[model samples]
Target: MKKEVNIILAGSLGIILGIGLFGLRKFLKKKSQDYDDYYADFHRHFVKQAKDDGNDGIEFLAVQ
Candidate 1:
């Protein structure tokens, strides 16, 4: 009986940890994609303005 209980507990813990890790990976991937998009948009806007104003533009840190 004790061994059975231990097996059940271990299985449950493993399943829970697996689910948590999966969720964390998905969240990080989404955040990385969002950051990439933000930077691309920033560069596009920056280049457009520089062209319009006829001045070489300097790159600054991207903001949200």
Candidate 2:
């Protein structure tokens, strides 16, 4: 009986942890992609303005 209970508890814990990890991975994946899009958009707006204004050209340097 005791061994059966231990097995059940362990199985439940493993399942819960698996679910948590999956959710965390998904959330992080979305955030990572979104951050890139937002970063590009910000740079794009600035570049657009500089491109339109011949005398207001800007230089861009991206460092990882």
Q: Where does candidate 2 have its weakest 10-residue lDDT segment?
A: 55-64
Candidate 2 per-residue lDDT over residues 18-50, each given as its tens digit = 999999999999999999988876677556343
- Going through the candidates in the order shown, the clash numbers are 0, 0
lDDT of 1 at 10: 100
Give per-residue CA lDDT, model 1, range 1-64, as digits (tens): 9999999999999999999999999999999999998887767744634245554355533331
TM-scores vs. true structure, each candidate: 0.62, 0.61
lDDT of 2 at 6: 100
Q: What is the lDDT of residue 56 in candidate 2?
A: 38
lDDT of model 1, residue 43: 70
| Clashes, model 1 | 0
lDDT of 2 at 42: 66
